[model samples]
Target: MKHAPRLTALLLTLALLAGLLPAASAAAPQPAEPRIAADSAIVIDYDTGETLYEKDADTMRVPASMTKVMTAYIIFEELEAGNLTLDTLVPISDFAAQISRNQARYPTAVPLPYGGSLTVDTLLRLILIPSASASCVAMAEYISGTEAAFVQRMNATAQRLGMTAQYQNCHGAHVHYLTARSQAILVREFIRRFPQILDYTSATSATFNGTTYPNTNQLLPGLAFEYEGADGFKTGTINAAGYCLSATAKRDGRRIISVVMHSDNNTTRHTDSTALLDYGFARLAADAPYTDTAFHWSWQAVEELDALGAELHPSGEQFRPEQAVTRAEFTAMLYSALAADGQLPPLPGPEESTQPAETAPPEDTAGEPEQPAPEPEPPFADIDGHWAQAYIEEAAALGLVEGDQYGRFNPDSALTRQDMMVLVDNFVELPEANGLGFDDDGDIALWALEAAARTTAAGLFGGSGGRLFPSASATRAEAAQVVSRVLELA
Candidate 1:
């Protein structure tokens, strides 16, 4: 493949803009906004192809082991095209075995015994899950007869995917120019074409040849800092590249892909990735429209409640469709909506202090002063002077919300999807379970199973791809829509 000089110039321009080149940083200080520790980072909505957040996203940097994502992509394409089968055994070359054993810098190397053999599927798993560099080169040679030819294919794939990256090696040992944006795009395409790759990326541990290799992507299950709904992805590290990661997650029917390149350290890569995922979810929620859309079925109900003069967000004009609703905020919105329909009593005003003013101790009863009524204890220790204190207390009084076992209502925490269903069950009579089969029914918390069934039957919530993500947090707009649906049912 012919390397483009223009690509080099573009990379140089981005490096200068990001203050990545030594001379560029020496020229001036970097900008302050979008403060991330990574040299290049980006978060994009997988479904809509929208970039939610970016910081030096286009800056060219070494991809390191992230090149395996492309390698796996090509392998999957080959599999689908009938060029390779999972059972096809690839002979372990002496060079592949030497690279695996000698590469002390790549800690994830798996011993590929020379004169032995392994299946294409197993090697692909090693390349993806543990990011084994030996497996990468072995697969490269097996597919194209030479690493040079495989490098050509990698560059061709990048070009076909509209990525402006330059790959010198198939295994990503030396410096290879790739941007965070290009990585995200590659992952997006990979997911679009072959979502089954998640099986490899999401595996917590894989056993091969009597050795168990843990996946390097720490966000997967049974690892430190495991994120809810996290599945497949990849992580990379090299002296030159620092720590890099390309992660993807799905929650509540929304999917996001994030890439962090050249993080300061391994821990920082995961932290940066977690922050990017949070930001992506927040961006999706913020960009979620209140009017007609996929959630458009709730549009009329929202409008109906609006017509009834029910004010959900007292501080905002637009209904923030994608923001997570806090426990206190949901309580307030529910109380107000119920009050509007007269299904619940009007919200009480602030109570006056029960302590009577001192009026000379009431001279007639000076010898027997009346005792003042004891003040009601605050509902939660955390909400003493909070703005939502009144709403929270009233909700507790009405039995709409019960404090957790710790005797504290975590008022500021995001209300969960299942918890929203249980809260709705308190006021409305939920329909019987209509046998709406969900793939994740067994994963639902025991306490939430009944509510999940009833809510699904009542049309209050639905499954995504046949799986009900019971633990996913409910957004502010989702809460409002559920409240509107409840009002209509009433």
Candidate 2:
């Protein structure tokens, strides 16, 4: 719903790979544009609300049964209003019963006996699991007096949601209008608002009035077309709508929403969604990939960073595992760790600084005219436009980064274990050395001895043979594990 944000992430990656950056940047290849057979499709990161991929997504098409997603949304709204409960027995009206009994008209309907009753919970399962049309009509009548009035609510809700849609009915029977993009947005909102809806949508089969109804969605568990983590939403195939699906799935704690409209058939509809979902999943994984980290001893720490959120992902590149952690990388990780806890104070970028240079010439000169002073050495000459510039700048502003002897940050140079302790010591008082002593304590610089002793005593460095290796360069894996553990301690 953000302005022009559609496919922005994908376009940025594409533009970067199109010779805008080094070939190595593209070494972790971006997933190719999926071969989608659907007339329109879209995929979005459910967490960021950012579009990961799209194809003719804004072109309006009949939403078909996907419209039931909204029906469920409204029903959820009504339930929250105290007007209905899951166990509330809804009356089986003449209209609803008539539609149910009319096999030619409502083939998906599980025939309801006239004047009989089913609970709102049962009806919800019937509609979601079986794509039962009469169940929708029944629920709509109970909520708004008539399905026609419910359609008005649906359209109004769509408009309120800023969806490009025109609702003609409660269930997707006759016809309705919705774009693939809008459908994705609607489902995103629906799931966000009523995540419990998944309890019903994830069901592969349900029994109604002693007749069992299998889920029309083939993406559920144990089906031939089943996709791992495939859960809720709906499917439809009217002549005009063709085969359409609005589907969602979660893998590795990340959820994605996709809509495939006008696919050739039911199988291909799932096929198109699978491709879109896979594209989305791969894109997010690339942001903080662990494909290279699994063999490392700290692989769990690397994976935990993904669960910790985007702050840990810095520049969306895999950390060099065996390589030494750099000063800039440490600064970025520390900044992100503090930020994730909302502990970062007001800090401005280098460009936002208003202070004069550290060695500025005096404003008043008594005799000779003063010439403009030469600019003082920058905090770090190498950081401008660097991939970790923002984090480094913020870290520098907070005094978390101090450049080396020549006033250079040495952003790419290896950070030693003692140096890691010094930097980390800035956040909290490193526990005093107490009685702890390492075999290599003499190798630690006098400046870092207390921090080295304290951090080692704290078990940050799991020394072997009583040697802490204080001056040895810390690997990326060690840095990540240390930082992650620090976050947990914080």
Candidate 3:
């Protein structure tokens, strides 16, 4: 037991980023394997493409409004290739406006101005957030001369993403058929590739030129069946589709994508999704490496950090929760936790970045002129030698950390609570907060005080017996706690 071979953690990154293998954090009272009311359903882990649950996933059924996800995917591809910009105007064609005018004839259509145009961005919002069939037709016409051409593209893209489907229309009205697995794969790929689509799908409501549009997905925030952390994808309901839905949510940095097709009603669609989501989370919780934190106060936090990935601690059996964490360790943990939550710092500007500029494709085969790569940042003198070096350096590259004015990272020094709060401030905008009312509030470093107060109100920091040890070195446990709370906030 003494020489456990550095415990490459068959437990938490001792909760580090390799992911808490074996859910050594173990199952937090998991629910039984879920049984759904839908005829076809599937649940998948967003990161690893692991199948967590499924039922008749390959059987074909009507897609209904779920087709908008495919439309949105094609639109994102256009945007990425610079073929279309958010500002690009898409004139509502007579054909599209005609459909929207008859909500009686076409129940899912939004009332669009037949001759007037809307921006590509606004149209996308209408299509995804509200599942507006008219908007979908408008975009289809703008992208292709006719809706037929856009349908061809959707089928081709579906084939490329390994989805099985026969797409009849942009809005899934003409009796579209897609397997539950295909829908899940479509959503997984959509999120993996164009997560920004969430900006629309997650919206509870949107105001168009003169009217308001509410999202059809009931699982998102401020809705009938609000599931916490649930954000995107689409919902489909029609006589043929029979209440189909594809739902996606993120919790503790792990994302779950679920698809339920051919449920009896709206209630069953959401309930089945909830069951699948619950089962998927429980399954994930029971996953990964092994370690016990000796039932510390930070057990939950440690579990959360471990959930981000594998750890590199020398001992798998013991996490040394009371150990005073070094600067490198804290920053590395923060980096992993934030990344798991998909909270990456924004990319540097073109002038400062080596990444290619977001330029549109050229008219001919002549490709973009290559730009010279930027110079590599000089290594932090005290950084490279640390085991957490890669994580620390990555954090530094994102401007999430910096060396002391002396150019030394001082990686080995103990991280005080004051410093921890300051580092967190770099990523999260601390909302205006009331006084923390900690006995040691006045003792906090002046620069860190405001951050401390804000974080305190955020419940990212807490006091014991009305005292916050501002200058005290944060232990591994405390750091884990802080990171987990930040994950919740994100």
Candidate 4:
């Protein structure tokens, strides 16, 4: 009996040891968490094919106007191959002209008559800035001698990038036959091909014939005017495809290209893209060698202030450019600089809050219970702050937050969750928030709650157990961490 028990104990010991040994051997170092900036987003090193971060990156959804990225790719290749030039003028074909008139599914043309002449550069500008379907068709015809052939080239290029699922029509309208997986593959392939598209995407707006065409990606201003290290790419929208954007930004010698598909609208797209860009610039490194200072760019700052200005110096001293800025005040500084630089247009007059007044309660009578005072709002200053400062100040200037009546930035004030949610609410205009299952969604006071939920669902912010602690104060670390977490979720 003693021998039998000993043998049983030895067998159990052997089995336990065997199980642990494999687990120990297979254990590898945990990989660093990926940081992403948008829902269904991706950041790729412009030079290398390495993916820095991804969220539903390979999930195929309609790319809407992002199809222009591939279109721009072909155009750029044509330019590089001497088939097209910035100044080269091309006649609009009947097919291209017809597509531009397509108000049914794509952006309508600006009454460019058939056979009207436009330069290749001008066409590029149109497609890139406002995502004109007419320009896309014209460029397609210009490249492949016909839209059919141009699509063939686009698909071939997609195949080269290992995007097996994407197929192109003259415009990026949905093909009933392709799976979402295929569409994503094609989009990813295009990204892999010309990472340089990001430079163009980051551009705030472009000028043609003395008229400035702003980027459909509104984050440009949201991040601040003439954002340093910012360039250009494009934006896309189709009712079926939702709102989409591909953005590229460079900072500290690192450039990241991010794509957001099926955003609810341009505002969501910008927030998502800004989140991704923030993460990439703050975290990742480019494969090519460079230093942090190379990514830095300058924005002009003015010291003047009124209701929207308070320069928060540690010792109440005059403002210094090198001092760290809070995300809120930094937005103001960037706008100030943009105004100085002539990048942003003149400011608009004070209007009632952009928030839905219908949702607000009627003013209380003197005898009634006192209503809570509304939070203060920021001045929409269009000055300049470079890169990081630009994003911060831009957020402020947009009335995404209320800055102190004085111009000083209180960088260390903890951001209340309600405040952050309110900032997000102010940032976007969404459809009515009801039947989404949150009671707060129906209330006017929870506007930020509604906005935050929408953004969160779009993968901009990861919710905590489906609840946003709106009353909690947000720390800088918490803010960055949340932003980073949201980037990863995106």
Candidate lDDT values, in order: 0.76, 0.76, 0.78, 0.52
TM-score of 1: 0.55
Rank candidates by TM-score, best first. Answer: 2, 3, 1, 4
- Candidate 2's residue-wise lDDT over 109-182, tens digit each? 68886998899999888888888888899999999998889999999999999899999998887776889988
Prediction 3 TM-score vs. true = 0.59
Query: TM-score for each prediction?
Result: 0.55, 0.62, 0.59, 0.47
Q: Which stretches of candidate 4 lie over 4 Å from their true place?
A: 1-39, 173-203, 206-212, 221-228, 285-490
Between candidates 1 and 3, the one scoring higher on TM-score is 3
Among all windows of 10 consecutive residues in model 4, the one with the lowest summed lDDT is 1-10
The local lDDT score (0 to 100) that residue 246 gets in candidate 4 is 68
What is candidate 1's local distance difference test score?
Answer: 0.76
lDDT tens readout by residue for model 3, 270-317: 999989988887666655323344234565567556765624242545
* Candidate 1 displacement at residue 486 in angstroms: 29
Best by TM-score: 2
| Residue 160 local lDDT, model 3 | 94
299-330: candidate 1 lDDT, tens digit per residue: 44555555555545534335666678988878
Off by over 4 Å in 3: 1-30, 290-490
Listed per candidate, the RMSD to the true structure in angstroms reads 19.9, 12.7, 19.3, 28.2
